[model samples]
Each structure stands twice: as C-alpha cells, then as structure tokens.
Target: MTAPVSRRSGGRAARKAIREAPLTDDVRPIRPGMEGGRYKPLSQEQVEQIHEAALKALETIGLADAPDSGVAYLTGAGAAQGDDGRIRFPRSVVEDALAKACKKITLHGRDPKNDLELWGSRVHYGTAGAAVHMVDVNGREYRDSTVQDLHDAARICDQLDNIHFVQRPMVCRDIADNREMDLNTIYACCSGTTKHIGTSFTEPDYVPPALEMLHMIAGGEEAWRARPFVSNSNCFVVPPMKFATEACQVMENCIEGGMPVLLLSAGMAGATTPSTIAGAIVQATAECLAGLVYVNAVKPGHPAIFGTWPFGLDLRSGAMTGGSGEQALLSAGCAQMHKHYGLPGGAVGGITDAKLPDMQAGWEAMCSNVMAGLAGLNMVYESAGMHASLLGFCHESLILGDDLIGHAMRCVRGIEVNDVTLALDQIAEVCMGGPGHYLGTDQTLLRMQSDYVYPSLGNRMSPKEWSENDKPDLIENTIARKERILSERSAARFDPLLDAEIRRKFNIHLPA
Candidate 1:
C-alpha cells in the first residue's frame, strides 16, 4: 500500500512538471486567427434587412464632401455626383465594386511567422487607438504620451503572444511637427516590433516620405511593395454619410504606395450616427460600402478592411461609453455584416471607460473582447490598453490584456466533440478496479498543454497558499513583468547598421 501511494505521488509530480513546461505554437491551446463565428447578434433576416437599408442609404442620401480626386475616382466608376456634390452609388455599381474587391488578404509581418490571414470568421486581436494621454496606474495619474511610450508599447506587444498586431496607439506629443510625428510613429512602431503595424498619415504630403522610410526598411521600393508590412488606418469617411476630404486624399496616396488600407468609419452613436442600434449599424455599413466602391474605383481588387466602428454613447451624459454592452453589440453586428459580404473586416473591442486597470476596466474589456471574438471579427482592433473612453492608454493594461485576450481566444476556440475527446476508454479504465480519481492518468497528462490555457499573471492560489507565498498584487506583478521585458535585449529591433542609417535619414525621436 505504501509503495503504491509513493508511485502515484511521483507520477503526479512528473505530470505537474510537464504541465508547467512551455508549449510550442503547434500544441498551444490558443493562437492567432482562431475561428470564432459562433455568436451572431444579427439574425439572417436582420442581416439582410440591414444590408438593404445600407444600399438604399447610399443610393439616396449618399455621402458629401468628396475631394476633387475622390469625386473624379467615384464619378469615373459609375457614381453620380449631384449638384450638391454628393456621390451616389447605384445598386449595380456597388455590386460591381463588391465583386471586384479582394475576398482574402494577408497582412504580412516583417517576420513571416506573424502573418495574419484575413477572411471568413477567423479572428485576430491587436491594439489600436489615438489616445493623447498615458495612464500611470501606480500613481493613478495621466500624462501626455511620448514617442518613447509608443516604442515601449510596441516592444511589450512584441513579447506578448496574444497581441497579433500593433497599431499606433497614442500621439507622440513630444514631437511638435505633424510630418515628423507621422514619420516617427512609423519608425518607433517598426523598430520595436516585427508584427504587422498599422498607422495613419496627418496629410497626403506626408505619405511619400513615410513610404521612403518604409522602402529603406524593406531594402527597396520593390521589396516594400512585395511584402508591405504596414497598413494605413485611414478614417476615410466622416460620420452620417460624408467623406473626410483630406483623409480621402491620404487613402489614395497609401493605395498608390501599395499599402493595405483599413477604411475606418468611426461614428459615435446617439450623435454622429443614429441612437438606435440597428440604425447605427446601417449607417456604418453604408459608409464602408461607399469606401469599398471608392477603393475599387481607384484600383480594382485593392485590399481594404471593412472597418465599421460604431461606438456607444451614454444618453444621459452624451459621453462616449466604449465599454458598454451596446458597444459590444455594435462591433459584433458589424462583424456579421462583414461576413455577409464575404470580406475581411475589423471593429473596436476591449476598451474601458474606467480610468485605470481596475475591476471596472477588467469587466468592461473582457465583455466586449469575448463578444467580438465570438462574432468572428477578423481584426479586433483596440483590443487592449485603452482607458478613460479612449482618452488614455495604460502599458500595464496592455500587458494584462495579453492574458485577458488569451482567455477570450480560448472561449472563441470553443469545444471539440470528437471521439477522442469523449474519453470513453479513459473513463472506463479509471472506474474499472483502478484509483478512484484520474489525477495522474496518461490522457490527462498528454492533453494538459493542448486542451487548456493558463494565465501568466492572474493568480489562482487559495487563501492559505496565497498567504504562504506572500500575496501578490496583479498590477505589481504586471509592472515587474513589464520591467523584465524592457530590460532584456529586444529581438524585435532593426539591424544595427540599418538602424543607424534610418536615424540619419529621419528625425526619429525615440532613442536607439
């Protein structure tokens, strides 16, 4: 009896060691581009109704304020410009544009291993925002975000497995000139991470210089075009059926430069868009369809994401409520519309109205993130680190979000109900004249890493164990991890000579 007990205990110890070991990408329980169309906020009929409404909107109300070039592009592609200068798309023209659009796109990373295949219900989560302030969670204070903050965010993202891509999250307040800011944003992000990056240009004139920098980074113009790792997050349209003229010009420049475009239309509900949920979705869809038409008109089959980011609002105070349930529904519904068109799409999620990475922030971020993934959003942007309704970004929150998104992705992975998963053989073996429990079973040990996900910073110890181990605070642990990452030599940095040349050519604000 003593010998049997000792053998069982040793087996348990061996199993624990195996369970704690690091897992390879192939065997990891969750990964980028996991399939997640399991939840549908809009029914089939509702989706069709919304689509029809959007088409009607484009045909009648149309969009105003197209720039001279945009007017030419749209009119040249069968759109009618009335005396009011609004471009109206006929059903046939919109359909043609849809038919010509690229059905699938690959967002290449500088390292080929991080490439994201965007199509269908496959989901990938990443960061995106334009917050001007950074949240110092420890001090409970907010301050102007700098270029170094942006670079550090990217470096932290580089080490996180769950953050699939890094979009420019904050303004570089340290840089005074808009052109220099745009260039440095690109340089700071690219130099910190090999993942696919998304950024915006302040002016159409800024595009050429930015592309020149990208060419240098990619070795040449031809090489840059072949594997363009950067995408322009272009807010091509103003809300309520209108084109932002300069933004449109920026979109055209990015297209001419062979970069993928995220045709973002971010309309605040109860203000820019309609108060009702369905109404907001309809407006966002119409605007994005118009954008698709514009993209195809400029260059047929151009890669563009259907970005319908309709945010939520607090009707009582008329303030943005990015963490609300209505916001989740908006993102999920837009995702359904993207699926309806068979196009790669993106929407905002994991935003928090709370000022810090506190309890409110946790619930808010997790709620939308899970819903967004469940709805199968191809690119879930702003999926972490946003706070104070997009006014602030927190580095600790971004680090913690890696663990949060991992759990969300696991939920997105859902259940696998195969014969092996049924475990009838294992069950029978356990009950038939064997130990009362299956704690040290071969099946349990073998499936430990593949079938489960474990959080890195989230504590799961009991009170007794917690006290015995010296209780750890979540934020404290996160800060320690953040320090560890920044202290290490980053693998994501550019080659030394190449970095020196880039610094010489551009006024990069972040130190080498």
Candidate 2:
C-alpha cells in the first residue's frame, strides 16, 4: 500500500491547483482615474454661493506681497495693482483665467504606465508630506528622517498597487545646505521610482540645477520637458491672501521652464482663516483663484492643479487638527469647488494625529480618505504613511496604507447595477436547485478575484485557527513585509551611464 500523503503537502498542492489566473486592467475592481463625486456634502446653491464669495474676495480684498514681476504679469492680464501695493484681480480676469486653464492634465511619470490623468472627478491617492521624523516601529521612537529614508519610502510606494504616485513625503536632514537638499530630494525620489514625483524648491535658483539632473535621467532636457515627470508643489500663498514672494518666483521659473505647478493655498481654519467651515473654504478658494490668475497670467492655459489645501485647527488649543472631522469636511468642500470650475484639483487627506499605526490611526486615516475619494478629488495628497499630524513618516505604516487605500478606492467605485451583476438567475438557482450555498458556482468563482479586494496584512482567521497559528501581530507582520519588499526590489531603474553623469554634475546623496 502507498504511504499516506502528508496533510501539509496535500494542502499546498491543492492551493496551487486552485490558484486564480492573473488579472488585467479591464478586470481591475479599482484603479487610478476612477470617477468619484458620489458623495456631495455641499448643495449646488451652496457651491455657487461660495464661488461668488471667493470672487468677491479676490476683486475686493485682493492679495498682498506680489513680487514686481508677478504684479506686471497680473496687471497685464487685467488685474489691477492698488495704490496700497496690493494686487486685485478683476472678477472678469479670474473668470477668463478659469476658462483658459488646463481643465484636464496628464501628470506624466518617467514610466509611461504610471501616468495619471487629472480630469473630471477622478481620484488618485499618493504620498505627500514634509515629515521630518521617521517612526522607528521596533523602538517605538521617532528620529530625524534621512535621504535613505526618503529613497526607501519611494521604493515602497513604487510597489504599492493603490498608491498611484510618489511625492516627496519627507525631508532629508542629512543634507545640510538648502540648495543641496533640494537637488538631492529630486535625485533620491527619481532614482527610487519612476512614478510622477512632486517636489518643492527652496528658491528659484535651485530649480535649474535640479532640472539638469532630471534631464540626465530623462536622457536630455528636451525629453524631460516633453514628459516632465516631476511637478513643483509651490505654496504660492502664505495664508489669508498674500503671495509667498520666493515661492511665487519659483512658480514663475517652473512655468517658464515647462514644468507643471501645484498652486497650493494651505490656510488653517480658526487661525490663518475664518473659524467657520464655509468661511475657511471661501478664503482658500479665493486664494487658489488668485493662483489660477497668476498661472494663466504667466502662461495662459498652462498645466496647474487648483490646489486648495486648507487645514483645520483645534479651536480650544489653536493647534492644527489634521485628523479631525472638520478637516475632512474642509478637504471635501474644496474638492466640490474644484468640480464646480471643471479644473484639475488637489487636496489633503488621510492624515492621523495618532503617533503610531494603531486603531486610532486606522480610523482617522480611513475617515478622511473615504470622504476625499467620494468628493471627487482629482489628486488626494498625504493619503498614506503620515502620522502625528504630518510630523512623522513610517515605512511599515506606508505598507499598511496600500491596503487601506485599496478599500477606499473600492468605495469610490461604488456598486454597478448591471443585469449581470443583478444575477437574479444565479440567486434563484442557488436558493431553489443548487446546494443551499453558491460557494462553488461558476459565477462566484469568476467574480471572486475581480470583485473583491484582499488586504495583504489584515487578519481573517477564525479564533481557533488564529490561536493555532500563534496570533500574528499586524505591525510585526507589516514590518516583515516591508523587509521582504526592500530586499527583493531591484535598484532604481536608471541607466548606469546617466546615473554616473548625474553624480558627476550634482551632489547626489543616494548610494549607487
């Protein structure tokens, strides 16, 4: 008689035999560019009222501190400079700029497959922060983030299916000089991943050197301009309506250099802006509208995201409360305003006040992310791996966020009520003729992989099995996954010749 087959070996063979086929783009349940707008927190009238208020603010209150060049650009485009030294945009000018703005833009990635189309209410999640600290999960302590940490974060984002782009999420404390820091930030992110990157420059002068390194990576300056893989996340507005002088100059340079710009207006409620939610939105909208005029004045119809990232504050303590419900509503409201103008927009979401990636972090992250997606935000920033109200970044938390964003995208996809999905016949067959369940049915098997999302680290084991399997810890398991990925991932997709040229030309900090 044959020796009895071992249960463990038999189980492995059975699992291998039943493994599902590979998935294709057509069958992917969730993906970048999925339309949102299913959740509308503001009525149409309310949106229009806010728009009117914003226009009034721009035409009346105006913006202060526009550089001489900016004043010239704005005045040439029908904006008036008052005797008080403020630049006032005529309502007509603002409207014209909005009409001429690039309604749909493609954020090109160094890898063509990672390109993101920004139009409609399509939602794309990605990393965005300037977190200075790195959370040491094992030690449960925070330390200054380094260039290595930035590169590692990019690499992690490159592999995560749900994170569509890799923006500079942390600053490199190792690089001392400001100019050096800017250039190295570019190198580290590009070398780490080919996804579309968002980086900021300290001054206008730093941009050119950074572009040269990018040119070498892109094969030439002309190629880099054609499919410029990086965008300038310019915080053009200081707050409650004033131009950040240096940032405005940087914006001008980026526009002239053929790079996309995110016209960022990050006003904080109850502090820099009005305490009321609607009032905060009005201020942010007015500020971003001025940004639109600035961009079009510089170069009409140029690529820019209508970025209105107004943050919330704790009224009691006057501290920023990024994870609060008020912050979520603020972001969602801004998304609605973006939809109103039919311009590509970006907003902040998925931030957590919790210092660690525990249950508190989970609830806070999911709340903002779900609302951002449902509100039809085109680009949702800070959607992963941010902690302690954006002061810290964690590698393991980034890995876990991939799973969180997957579920959020599923919500954006909503339900399809097609005839096939209704499956009246399948239901009847299961209830009347087939076994009391439909677990092994053809339709069930066909829809399983396409219609469902499985978390990489989430637990689903029954109590008995969990105890038998030693009750794994989510954080520990996620750390293991992070290690496996970093170990198995190939070096950045850079040509050896170009990489060497980049090093010779610039202060490249990342190791070859």
Candidate 3:
C-alpha cells in the first residue's frame, strides 16, 4: 500500500517495510544424506558406482562421429575413434570436462543470469525438443500454436514458481518456417515473464533474434555474463547420426560466447542404439563426450550437463514412446554416465502414450519422472509425446503434468528441520499434556503450507457435498485450473518494436 496524501498523527505511513521472514537456507539442509520425498534418492555409494561406470564407458569406448571438432579434442587427448564411428574417450577427458564445468549454476528466473543455480542440492527441470503444443488456461486444446496460446502458456508458467523454466512449445505445429513460430513465440513468452528459456537456434542467422530476446530478460551484458546463456544441446549421436552444421555452429557459438550447454544423446534400443542397456549407455556416453570436447575446446570453463535416453522403440510402430520402462532405465543409466564425467545429469520425463492424460499418462510419467528425480537428475525435461524421438507434444499431458510435477516436488521436499520440527520442547510438552487437543495452537497455524500441498486435482470432499455441486474428477479439476489460470493470467510483455524488427529480420509471419 502506498502512503496517503495526508499523514496520520501516529506517522503510520513512516514504518519501513519489513520482510515476510528470512528465506531459508534450503540448499544446505537438503544435501547428501537425509531422506525426505515421494521416493528415495540414490545413496552416495550408488552415485559413486554410477560415476565409475560412466568413466569406464567413456575412456575405453569414447563416443561416435562426435563432430570432428569435438573428436579432435578427445582423440588428441588419448581417446580412440574406431571405424564404426564410436570414438571411445579416455577417463582423463571426462575428468577434464568436469574439472572445467561449473557444477553449480543459478539459472536466473527473472534474469537468465540471476535465475538458476546448479551444482548445489537444488533439483532443476526443463525441456529441449520442438514443434510444440500448448494448453490454454481453460484446459482447451490449442493444436499447433498461435501467439495467443504462446502468451497464455507463458503466463501460466510465469505464475508457477514451481517450474523453473519454460521450454518453447510443449509442441508447436506452426511450422510455416521450419518452426520459426516456435522461435518467435519462445522468445516472446520468456522475455518479460521469466528469465530462463529452453531453446535452440534453428539456423546460423536464426540466433540473433532468440539471443537478443534472451539478452532482454537477462537485462544487459553484466547480467548475461554472470549467468551466461545456457541451453539444451541434444548431440545427435545414433544410427545414421551426426550433428547438423547449424547445430554444431550454434553450439560452437554458445561455447565461444561462454554459454552453458546440456549435451544430450537420445536413441531407442535396437533401432538406433544397441538393444542392451550397457550398449546404450556406452553409446550415449560417447555422444555426451563428443559434445563436451567441442565445448571444452572453444571455452574451457563453459558449463556442461551430461545426459542420454535409450528408450525402446515399439517394433511394430518403430516409434519411441515416452512411457516405456526402458525410459526409466535409460534415464537412470544416463544419470550414471553424467556422474562419470563428474558433470550434472539431465534426462526426459512426464511421458506417456495415451495420446492424452489418463492412466497411461500417470503410469509413464510417474515412472520416468519419479525415477529421474530420485536418480538425482540435475535437470530433467518435462512434457509428452516427444515420442517420435521427442518430435511430438500433447496438450493434456502438459496440464496433467502440472499436478505430476507438484507431486514430484513434494516427494523431494525432504525432511524439515525448523524450530517446530526440531521439536526441542513442544513435542515433549504435547506428549506430557496427553495430546488431546487437535487444534488451537500457534505452531499449527504457522506450519500449514509446509505440512500440506492442498490439491487442485485430488478427491477431498464428501460425496454428498460433491454431488450437490455435481462431482467432478481430477481431470475436470485440471481443466478448471487451466481455465482459471488463463482467464485471470496477466499476459506478459515484449518490445512490440523489437518484435516487429525480429519479424522483419527473420522474414517470417504468423499464420491465421
């Protein structure tokens, strides 16, 4: 509230604004040992073992056709590239990247540089694939995408403090210009609304627009310098594989400019990668090593995230389904390999083949997301249909996933150690006093939010009360939440002139 034109006798308007309370040093409390969440994290011992496995895979069997520039660094440093295209790396290369990689980064939310921090105990999430799909606030399915849907989705994502970053479309069908709508929409949505964005420059000339937009949110050079632009770099390294010149060039630019990269290699068993988990891990390890070498070569200290996915393809369909159990195993293995490099691990999740959010969605998403989370993925991609090797996206899954992410978060909240939970005397007092009272206490009032995640999509009311208003299920609640969010959401802003300029620069137009 602002001061009144006239002051009251008590000088009520003169009180300095006080903070709500100090922010908890949550990062420290939730490190290494203690457990608290929907599932258990790998023990330190397990993490060590996985890391070792990744090292062994990298040194003896490096990675394949990993862009020539990347291979030059590795093989030049004791790696071996076989005729088969698999360039096996030495343990030293993995150690080198990890040595140079900034393990912890704060990926700023409002300013790309001020936002996110990795390498701490903080768990982060984001998506990297394209041709997006979106859901409006009212739970309406908006096929392909429009600037309107883009604005609405960005608004909702902007509102959710839970989600750290917004990847461009969940799937944008507006491919009039090689997913250029995706390019502009991603920039427009993230600029003023949030600091972090998940994107890739589609062409060599395509980078300026996206980078400028990102630079806008980052404020200026000092800010961008501090955070450095970080993004998803799925190093294409499977059957019939090689990185695109544009992809490699953009990646080269990112490293040269000191931006961070997530070197990801995805494949499906038998079709693109070996059918065995170990083979897939080796294959993925090589791919990540290849990417790391390129980054490390250009800018030695650039941050790098290591990852992979060897999801099995349904032989008949020859399509990668997000819900495959193999996805869980692949993600788990990827986590191990990333650890091998002593780099942050990343993977994909919130997957399913239901073509919609239903039981299949729940199962596939729960398994992959939960496993990835528990396995301690530094950053994991969330959303669905990405099944055509992450080429597709479904809207309903995105909504249902909001709830799933909530649960995943709650699972990882960890045990609390505040004044109350520390329970130095209160618990003893309650026990001695005979625990009869259920309420009417200061402590209870102070801890409600911490104790519960009041649901937006769970069954909680009496059937009588529910029926009176016409009972609705979780899906309905999800739909309603979407509607409410869209209706009330304040759309974010962008530089209209700058946007117009970018339109001219790209020579692209939105379709009707």
Candidate 4:
C-alpha cells in the first residue's frame, strides 16, 4: 500500500521537501550494471552448501543450551544430547524442518494488514538490537540516553519512511528499573506511529512486564498480534561466549507470539570466537542457527529470520573492532550463510567506528552499506548514524547516513529499461540525420527527473545559483530540510487523551 505522502519541507519555509525516499536503488535490471566486482555474488547452490555445513555444525558439534523442546525433538529424532548440554542432530532433522517450514512471513504492524516487505530482491534496512546515544532536534547528543530520547528517536524514525522496521533503540534510561522503563518506550512506539514496533524486554521478570505493557498499550496479545506493532521480531541470541537470562526470555516471547524471530549473535573474532573472520562467521552462524532451529522445533513452521553480527578483535588493544573489514566480510558472508538455510538473511551496512561525523566515518560507513546492498542482504540494520558503532551515536551522522543508504540502493538496484530509457524511437525521431536535436525533445524533459539523483549533500548547483542561496554547507541545507518536515507534518497519533492515560498509567513525561 502507498504510504501517505508526509514529506513536507521541515520548519524552514524556503527549504526543499525531503520526499519519502525509495528503500532500494530504483536503478537495476541493467545487464552488467554495478555487477561483477571484486566481491562475487554466491550462487544458489553455493549458498546451499553453507546451509548444509551449518546444519552439520548443528548435527555433529551441536549447540549447547538448546531449549527442552529442541532437546526433546533432537533426542527423539535419533539425535544425541549429552549432559554437557549440547544437542547434536543429523542433517536430516534440520533439512526436514526447513522443508516443512514456510520461510515467507510478514510480521503485522498495528494494522496486521500493514506488513513490511521481506525476501524481495533488494536489501531492506533496519537497526541492530541496541545502542546508547540519540540525536535531538538541534543535532545535540543525549548520552546514557533517557526515556525522552527513546520516544523522539522512535518518532523521528516513524516519520522517515525509508527505515523499514524500528528496532528498539536504548530508549529506557534505567536497566535497573525495567518495570517502569519498559512501559514508557513500548507505549510510545505503539501510539506514535504505525511502523513495526520492535518489542524490548530483558530477563525473566522483565518478560511479564514487557508483555503486560504491550497488552496495556495494544489492548491484549490477540489484538497486539492482530495489529502487531512488530513486523519482524529479531532478537540478540546470546553468544556461546556470553549469557543473558533475559535474552532467552525474549526469544521465547518472540516464538510464543509467532513474530518473525532472528537469532542475532555478535562475538569478537580471536576473542569470544576464533580469531579468523571465517571462523567467526561459522561460529556466529552456528550460534544463530542453534537458536533458530529451536524456534522451528518448538513450533513447527513458525517464521524465522536468519542473522549474524560477528565482531573482530583489534590486534592492538584486544577491543571488539565493530567496523573492521572483518565485519564487512562477516556481514556479507552471513547473508550467504543464511541463504543456505532457505531463511531470510539479516545483517548491517552503513556503519562507522569513527568517534565523530567526519570523512573516515562516511567512507567506512559507505563500504559496508554498499556491499550489503550489492550482496542483497534481506534485512540490513544499522542504517543511520552509528558512530563507534555500539559505542556512540551522532546527530549529524543520521543526516549523512540516509545518503549512504541512497548510494547502496543505487548500487544494488543496477538499472531499469523501458521505452524511455532505451531512447530508441526518440533517438531516431530527434537526431536521425542532424546535429544533436535530442536535447530539445519533450522526451528528455520527461526523463530528467527520473534519471537524476537529487542528493541531499552532493548538490552540484551552478556557482551563480549557489552564491545566491542562503544555505551554504550541506549541514545547513539538511538542518533547514529537517525543520521543514517536523513543522509541516505530525505522525498518526493515538490520542492526546489516551496518550495522557498511557502516560498516567506508565508515569512517563511525553511530548506535549
């Protein structure tokens, strides 16, 4: 369904409008367009082999801490579960589950009728599980993030149509007081917009609270699922390297609710995981597959998303190098690995480990994003401004990020052909025997807007025109653009009164 056109220029009366941008590059299908690069695309059969290898890792080595249902199924199906807490299954079991599984699913938004597109040809962008800082209206940082930071980020995200799903960013300030914190964030997303609301909960007791809050905001589980806020429910699957009791509960809730669950595992290469990128890829794959197989095992045919975010260690200080080349390779390889399983693949692009928004951040960020789109990842997260990755977030970075994603959309989309693009008849009609008369044709006028990319930053205006304009740098132009949008548009709200009621129940201070 066509979303409502909400792209008004922000508060700045004279600024140009920021249109609802396209997710994938509208350019593709052209033969040899941005294809056949140093990085090779995996063949369908090659992807299958990784799937088999992943299944073998599960069957032979077996992942530890599989749920009781998983253990029971593996044991019942001629598998072995040693007291060591690892359960090994034969390739047949995994193959059987995948065969019986319907990999295609649409996690419903508040309107079950409203579904996020998945498994399409191009990559769709999303955010990974967690991050700390957030950007405010004036491009300022709110560190250690609070409840207000969370809701506004969600609200800002809700307005940006290019973002496919809203992963629960660190909105709640206090992990210690999750009971009070969860309510504000969950209800804010439920009431603020119709985009998929990624649910947030941690630990055992937090599970009941999260569910209670979701029910409170959404009416109840049946209603919540019916007009489900979360379109695709992907979670952080604790690495074999670490444990969080709450992550497990989160997994359980995802399955029980039948939301699309992606088991996300991130471990550093050479540290928590083996030093090599290949080694980390396999280990991380094993980690997520181990959990996903549980999802399939518990409720046969349940929709599951496949994911991996394996970090690599910096040889220097033994730190988790988030935006390393190893990460890029791992994310691309992760997409291929998941493709092997015939499941939806999820990974990140547009990442930066830079401490600030600068050239290094933009360049490093563009590489991951472009590759992920070229590799055609199913769900690519961390699309916006993520500086130092999980360590920091910058405001201006988000403005720069959408353009990086724009380029990725460009790279993956390739090219499209039509009567206009071919220009065959037009060329013959306009310039058959004369000097180039094609420029004078109505055809050229009709096609200019279609072909040119009106970039947010890379404006190539004439020097005279540029001198005349009040806006100078790209940041000035972007700030003006944002003000125009927030001023002219407000997202679909639940109700001022119901919002007040939710705030009264949750004791949150919402935007007036």
Report the number of the highest-lDDT candidate.
1
Lowest summed lDDT across 10 adjacent residues in model 4 is found at 28-37
Q: Against the true structure, what is every candidate's RMSD?
A: 1.8, 2.1, 7.8, 7.0
Native-to-model Cα distance after best TM-score fit, residue 188 in candidate 1, in Å: 0.5
Q: Residue by residue across 346-456, what tens digits does model 3's lDDT show?
A: 777766665555576677877877676666666767543233345445444455565566666556664667786886576666777747553435565455444544444
Q: List, residue by residue over 446-499, the lDDT tens digit for candidate 4.
A: 444445444556666678768888547876666665556445434646657765
CA-RMSD of model 2: 2.1
Question: lDDT of candidate 4?
Answer: 0.61
Off by more than 4 A, model 1: 1-16
Candidates, ranked, lDDT? 1, 2, 4, 3
Clashes of each: 0, 0, 34, 21
Q: Which tens-of-lDDT digit does each residue in 1-512 have in candidate 1?
A: 55456875587678667767878988999999999999998999999999999999999999999999999999999999998888999999999999999999999999999999999999999999999999998889999999999999999999999999999999999899999999999998998899999999999999999999999999999999999999999999989899999999999999999999999999999999999999999999999999999999999998999999999999999999999999999999999999999999999999999999999999999999999999999999999999999999999999999999999999999999999999998889989987867786788877888998888899987899799888988999999999999998667788899999998998888777
lDDT of each: 0.95, 0.91, 0.57, 0.61
The better-scoring model by lDDT among 2 and 4 is: 2
Model 2: clashing residue pairs? Answer: none
Ranking by TM-score: 1, 2, 4, 3
Q: Name the regions of candidate 2 deviating beyond 4 angstroms.
A: 1-22, 489-491
Assess candidate 4 and give its TM-score to the true structure.
0.82
Model 3: residues with Cα > 4 Å off, grouped in runs: 1-88, 112-114, 131-148, 179-182, 212-223, 229-232, 239-246, 315-317, 383-396, 416-441, 488-491, 495-512
- Give the distance in Å from residue 200's predicted Cα in candidate 3 to where it truly belongs: 1.9
* Stronger candidate by lDDT (1 vs 3): 1
